[model samples]
Target chain A: MGKNKKENRRNFLSMLGTAALGGAILSPVLSKAANTALSSNVTEIKNFEGRIEDFLGGDYTNIKLRMQDDVRRAMKKPAKERKWAMAIDLRKCVGCNACTVACISENALPPGIVYRPVIKDEIGTYPNVSKRNTPKPCMHCENPPCTDVCPVGATFKREDGIVVVDYEACIGCRYCMTACPYEHRMFDFGEHYSDGLPAVAAYDERPSFEYEKEWTRENKHDSPIGNVRKCTFCAHRLEEGLLPECVTTCIGGANYFGDLNDPDSVIAKVVSKLNVSVLKEEFGTEPKVFYIT
Target chain B: MKKIFYILWAVAFILGIIGVGMRLMYGHEPAAYGSRVVWGLWVAMYIYFIGLSAGAFLLSSLVYVFNIKIFEKVGKLALITALVTLICALLSIWFDLGHMWRAYEVITRPNLPSSMMAWMIWLYSAYFILLIFETLYAFRIDSGKYSGEELNRLKKRLKILASIGIPLAIAFHGGVGALFGVVSANPMWHSALTPIFFLVGAVASGSALFTAIFAFFWKNKDSEYFNQMIQILAKIVLVSVLFDLLLEWAELSIALWMGTPAHTAGYRAMLFGDYWYVFWIFHLLLGVIIPVWLLATKGKKPIAIGWASLLVALTFLGVRLNIVIPGLINPRVPGEALAYIHPRLSFHYFPSLMEWLVALFIFALGIGLFFIGNKIFKLTEDTENKAL
Candidate 1:
């Protein structure tokens, strides 16, 4: 029995040595073959057609790249023909708040004004606990209650379905703020994040490009200082053919944006295919922002 | 007593000037109302003063339109009170605006059809013009400046203006109620009864103010007619107070009965929240109970009725505060308040000192204007006796 075991061990070692040598000899050829196959796969991806859902089904990654292409494609259409929308996948969101910080930095938002806030709720008892993180942005509703309540037609919905406030026209009565069911609108109380400091930081006083206008906080009595502000879906960025700050900065790739008017767009496909819902559907606002639960 | 009152008014006026200076220099920096609780003490004061004006105007219509003989002596006084209080209301709202200079936009580029606010502005503009003309006509006829058909023509014109004013008062005040009611976002304010509730509140508080002023400051206190008028005004105030209480009960009880979190959250915050005493102590105890008891038991005594009406008039601000604040304290999205951390982003709200100072200034200014106008116009002159 001892002799047989020794012979088996020797045979196994010799086989292992032969296999290692053979693998080394064939490594370059195998690598070249793999590279060729990968190139062909890239070509296939580049030439990919059909629904976004189908594309994502094959490869769940590269969603941002796909949505970017969707944006570029939508930009070719006229402003009136394009409808901007956002879809957030709750499953993908880890609640890192990268999007929230990104939005503040992009807009130069003051202390009191927040365009997007991720609401984190912990449900159930300790053993069965689960968490939900919902990022609340302006719904940009089809039937916005805010626009209807502005005493001076200061706020209105654009043809492309973005609700914007004419900061100059806003008398700062904040009626629109109260009128919003989502409470998305915020009144700029002329506050600064660096208030009470010896000198306000340059970043705190930096101008935000909203509605394609440079709004500076140099004067407290200026337009945006007292005006009502909300998420315009980063309208200025859209005008420049770019995605919203939140969409681009979401580390989880949870946020998707595109033209809802285009049936081929990623957002449209996601909305139609997924079990999507809106915040406060009972209000009948018909929100453009959809949440994939 | 008059000396002490003057001293208090002087102090308030001085402090008010300082508050105005701070408001100008710092903008909204000193105000406590943040982005979440957007409207605060100023808004409450605005509605309070405006309700007083609307109520006073409507009551005066009883004299001018219905030609009620007993209230005739107080008609001009009521008009002057309405005008002064209207000015105070406008000032309160004007200070609350983000752009006080751009307020004219509501008139120039108004969204009239969809906006209840625009309708309010337009209606009030008409009411203001009508009020001015009505006051001028009533005073001119009382002055005996013209004789015969001209006098009759003036009286007829005054009657027409007052008649027009009745509907105008109702619409404007009811519009104010609709302003809050139409906000479907706030389950507390969104009610079909809000407009009616506002009208009732306006009448109750306004007549209470008129009662207190007449009881305390009538020119001829010893006149037998003065006692009768005081007793009658006390009865009007007592009924209106009870009615206002009924509406309050309906609003609170209905909301609390269902106990639906969405509908009852605001009421819960109002009745059992940190400032619960505002409803219980300030409004129910002082504004309603004490005033009701005094007006009911001592209805014939001018001094007692005066104190009761004064309590109702002053403490009614507690009612306004209850209405405006609780509607905003409960956020639509749960955990929204916790999601954002900033002083101004907070849901918790209490009016800052600056806000109270500004309000005090407005009140003092209104009183000063009333006295000045009374001196100039002899607002309480027994014009009927002199004319007869």
Candidate 2:
């Protein structure tokens, strides 16, 4: 339990400078990433958890984790509705590019790379067909090819059906990029945000999954660069009680995010009822992103 | 003539040095062949030099190991040439490693399945040691004419050790071929037969080395003995290239028949994909089949043999490129476009001025030092006392 608390403290520390998260977030995060966080010894757990609890003083602090009731509600939603999924309704998309802009601002990504883009394709050969714009983001595959060839397990498939990269464990070989047929992976190669590259280059300095913005700012050295990158399904927001920025700003609701496992979930209903499919199913990557045919 | 020759040599040296230096300092752009093409030009060069070095070393061994007097005339030159090319081969790999500083860690923290990585460290060290011993032994055997019992015993012992070195030399280089062949990830190269292919190519290239350099040296010598050496070398070249082609055809034939997705795609790529032109025209016609025919039929004609030798040398360079580049271009899975482009000199690569200067300085610097080293040791093969 203490091991989890330490991670929560670390996660909590990354959140210090952000505006207050209001209420309803603390109990469960402490239960999840921190419960098994301690070294095995009972004495060790007592000392460490006591040290952290003392550091936090009394309870009633606001963290950016999900409220317990929210998680339970999400779980209770029928299998079709509760599990997460994303739909890019190409028909409804106007190509306004707001989703692309929102993903960039939210990720605080470096220049020369972007998490999403509207790729324009033309169908007709000789004045017959029309032009269509499609947005490209990470597929967050069920059998994510990037996770398959990661030699050191740095890029992994999480319990929530998302593939995430543990940047610290990354060896910087960039073998994952070659494995990905989608060409989603990018190498950082010492990139930075303009002249202030080194000054604010640390991941801890950016918005992270933590309790307060100030603590996160002070402890921003935890996430490193000179590694591979990709869209993370906005996992940090998934932890907070908000929908991903792209999904919220998608004006057309051309994009949807909900549990695929839950039958009553919006994602499940659309996938089962609508004639939807995924890109490159022939490659057997089992991409999580659903597209209405 | 000496001044003109030095100028030409200097120009080549400068180009290589500048190419090397540019890669080190500028830290290479992503599109400069992309990280996927890491084994491109430099790796091709490395294998090329290694083949040359092994060829020269093995040729020199024939005289010492078998006590062949007819081949003794160029023994010292052969040994030194081997050493130079070995160093050149190492420089190719050094330039290739992206984490060049951590190169030593590959040895210290070894991943044993990475056969190329392991063999690289081992054979380089072994080849260096063998060259030193062989050079000193060559000098000592020559001294036996002046001295008495001590020198003759030393010559006998050195010959015995050199005989053992013959097989080790073969293994050292053949193991290098195994490095690429064993990688299942690369369908174009993966095969149990690759090591044998490498061995035969080494011999073919090695024989051609004798023919080319021998012709250069023969210009200043009496023609009788020179012609004799050329005859023997031509035979070696003819047989080796023929055998190598047979083996390659077998591998390709098997790959064609397998019809598995990866194997068939790789075969199609070599025979008909983008790589088809280079494979059919540049490497096969120029590198193997045509030169084998030329060497077999016209070897005694010095001009023919000379042209054939140079063609063979250039062809082997093409072969090295094909081996590394084609394998990388194999699509990772079925129906996907290959991620890597075949490495070329002109793409995003201009051997930066420094890269040219530094690689030139390295090669020329090594060659110049080697020349001085021979002069210091007086490494002549005139050991009449150790009679043929």
Candidate 3:
């Protein structure tokens, strides 16, 4: 009885070995089939790179090239000497929300936290109505109200005129939010879009490069999750000699970014226009962002 | 009545534990205050309790600083209440912070020149230290362990502390108002009168709380001094309420009458918006008129005085809510609220259930602390009491 049992066990082991070899041989074939199916869709979108023109199908304006040139010129000077500025032409803004989406993608903003939005206003009656779109980003004011109200000295205005918040130092009092006239600040509530789902997806756990630092939301109770957030003018991208994501993604070619200290820059000429204005001018925030009608 | 009080306390304590647990686990995920209406019930409760602390401390000053003979008996009680309420106030604001763990950064790296909040933190720290020493001295003298020259020396020390505390209370409480007043971004809170108004409101609410505690909790309430004390406190609260009302009217009439959109928008929202009852009913009617009438018609009666004081103290939260919310609801740029659409991105706000539960927990904790202190210290004026 023991000899028969040993012989049956050896036969089962041999069968298992044969099945493992067959499965290994078939796995590559199955993967090849899957790869072919996915490659067709991948080829169609391979060149898109998340640009607005990829979806809108418009001629390339080369605005990104000019902005990149401006960024390169600004990088040569001392950080304090080169003042970063942005200009938005309301006439050219189609309000396609490309800049808003681009900013979210660049910053990897969590749910309910937005750094930029295109405010739409309807003018006149229904029959004669015309809609006006204004894309709003952080004003990066020379005298930012948000910076002055931070109790912990977490948020401060740099000599280069950018308002930056030190996530490590911020106590998340939200006092800065109350003090901001623009209402541009947003608090992170540590929410996940993947909540209540069967499983959390990889995208939900992805890390972002903000302030040129790789930050992963490994836990709910962490910095930037409890901290207030606003636009940093793609400062991380700027450090790498790349234009802001919004400036490149603007489908209407409305947004311009450059060094305000450089007279030859496109943003400098755009900001000099007589029609240029700013939101809540009475606040004396002296916003670095200019809007042209 | 005693059984009912115990039952309520137990319920509140349990619910408070759950609320605190949720806060620890979630971290403001349950709160309704968004970026638009950034300051909500917690902020209101913070100012409300801080105002009570300032008010109670100042009323005690009448006995210690000004040598008012009438308030002498409840001097220790008033100080203890102020200390307890200040703790409650600090906890409320502490929980409201997003990074509560990093709250120490305010003391370590204060931006004094540009931030009124930083100034408030530093001033309150000084006030807190002063309060501890003053409370200790009150107990030390009442111990009756030292007689003659030593007692006189203790009294003199207490007087010096109280004298210093008068300005400290004013500076910190007025600094709280200045914290809001300096925000020129919100026209509703930007007036120069904001700090003065906050000081008066604090006094009114604080004195009312003191009067109620004396009438309801004093073991020897049948004493002749109790009746006179109640009447005096009732009169003081009445005058304070009237002055606060005058300030409210001045602010409302100036903004409403001007009809300028920039200034009037927030005022209009307060008086006529969806939460209009918060101002008209809770604050104006219940907080002001009912108490004023009760205090005026039956000022001599202890029960009437107690009820009026209690009503005023409880409903003053509505007054605080009005001050915080209206200032934040109006957007600086027109149509700013429409720029984004999210649950928390709007200009409208009311506290969530979690907020109320957490507030209730703080209230229960404060009551427990006060009761424990009373048991240990015997805060009554009776000479035969055990020494602290």
Candidate 4:
């Protein structure tokens, strides 16, 4: 056993040396390859389909184009027939918060309202420490506790499995906020970045077209202000044949969004894998969002 | 002393008017409650006042339904107290709403199956109407205008109304408890014990308030009848306090006995956090211990019993604050508190000055309503000489 351990240590050290030498030799050639690929931009779907083998063989695959394809494919089906889902790859996330920023801008979120937040966890003690970034958004659960607690019928799950809040009907009692285990919902306290300033800017006045309705934040007591706000999976954008802002803005290409009902769709393809885990599955919320470690 | 009380009420009323104006004009912008701690002092006060209302209403039923003659004189006062406190409770919750005007939607287009709040609203409405009619029948029986047969019929009507009110009060207040209890996310409140605790708390605090009023306001203070009433009420309040304490112990010890971090985080915060004094000093000491001591040591003394009951009634707000705040102080996600820094996203919370001012206004409004009710209607047995 002692001899085997010594031999194993030597083999590991040699493997490390070989890997380092290979990395040094390949770095320049990989850069040159990337440069050439960037220069020869073949950005058409039909041409891309014809050159699918070449694209597959290439080191860099454009995820945005792939996501656009996924969105288009899912849009062809009826809303009820398409079950929307999100799958997040934990390994790829750098916690740059681009997805969070994109969600805020898309939703016109106020200072207190955050529809998506990346939670950072530092695991293990100093010498063995490694960090994990988990971006949380509204899970749009099948058995949503938030919907059942709404005093008014202001929030409900749709046929296509997205939980939505009707700002006009919501009493702003915020019972739903307490009911949500994930704490994904936030109350818009009718505050703006330009609040308490001498003159509020026009950007603050711009209407956010949530649920395909024009919600202009004209005053404090208006709908969406003093109401529970949450991520809608960018439903308005989805209806307009666009991917959710978070999916498109993720720099690491960690987030996948598509019809879970379509087995051929990107999200549907990865979600059923053994590695995928849903947050608080023991609570039986049946969350549509899955995380892969 | 009476002049000083009036002066305090006047000052509170004026400041309260300003607070109401601020609330109406600015909405929840002036409050400290954020998205993280969604409920605040107003929610606490709302439950506090509602508990008092339900307690008082139930006590009145004890006389009319159970025919507890010792509490007969205060029965009418209890009903009136219920009405006044119910109004205060409604107003307290109304101001807490993000959109106060849209509150009517709760009744007009309520989602019955999904929400306990919808049921609470409907039940409160039914209870409100029943209370008004029951109090009126109570007044009619006391008016002495009817003959022997008519008076008996009026008494029968009052008993029937009280019988209906017993279940209605239980359902309405239990619905309030279920409103918080059904929240599976909040481990502190999600228990089979929540509704039972609320019911017991309502009785303890309600009877305490009724006892104080009897001790201070009853005309024949030196009469044997008065002492008998105070003794009985003191006993009721004492038993209730003990029972409520038992429920509280079960809630605390069960969560804390094993010391599971997830289950005990809220309780630990309540017992050891920055506002630990709220649970230990305010709720346990002033609300429970001191009152329990006074009731025990000086059970027969009207003055001591009155002071004990008064302290219990006033300090029960601390118990309410503990309930509303602790359940929400702990973040759901580990690093969610630090994920984004915003006042609304904050885990730590205390009511803003504006919130207190509004609460003062609500209490002053209740007093004013009670005084007006007393003057307009023969709400008390002694006030039979007044024109109805």
Choose the strongest candidate by lDDT: 1
Structure candidate 4, residue pairs in collision: none
* Maximum-DockQ candidate: 4
Q: Model 4 chain A — which ten-residue stretch has the worst lDDT?
A: A42-51
RMSD of 3: 15.4
lDDT by residue for model 3 (B1-388), tens: 9899989998998898888888888898899999889989999999999999999999989888898777777889999999999999999999899988998988999998789999999999999999999999988887878778788888899899999999999999999999999998888899899999999999999999988888788877788877777778889989998899999898788878957798888888889997899899988888999999999998888898889889889999998998899888887777678887887788889888889889999999999999889888777544442211
Each candidate structure's TM-score, on Cα atoms with residue i matched to residue i, is: 0.91, 0.62, 0.90, 0.90
lDDT of 1 by residue, A202-271 (tens): 8887899988989999888888977899999998887777899999998657888999988877888788
Report chain A TM-scores, every model.
0.80, 0.64, 0.78, 0.79
Candidate closer to the true structure by TM-score (higher is better), 3 or 4: 4
Stretches of candidate 4 off by over 4 Å are: A1-61, B375-388
**lDDT, candidate 2, A111-146, per-residue tens:** 444556666666667434344656767788777756
Which residue runs of candidate 3 sit more than 4 Å off their true CA positions?
Answer: A1-61, B384-388
DockQ values per model = 0.62, 0.05, 0.54, 0.69
Residue A76, candidate 4: how far off, in angstroms? 2.8
Best candidate, TM-score-wise?
A: 1
- The local lDDT score (0 to 100) that residue B25 gets in candidate 4 is 88
Our tally of clashes for model 4 stands at 0
Q: Deviation in angstroms for B157 in model 4?
A: 2.0
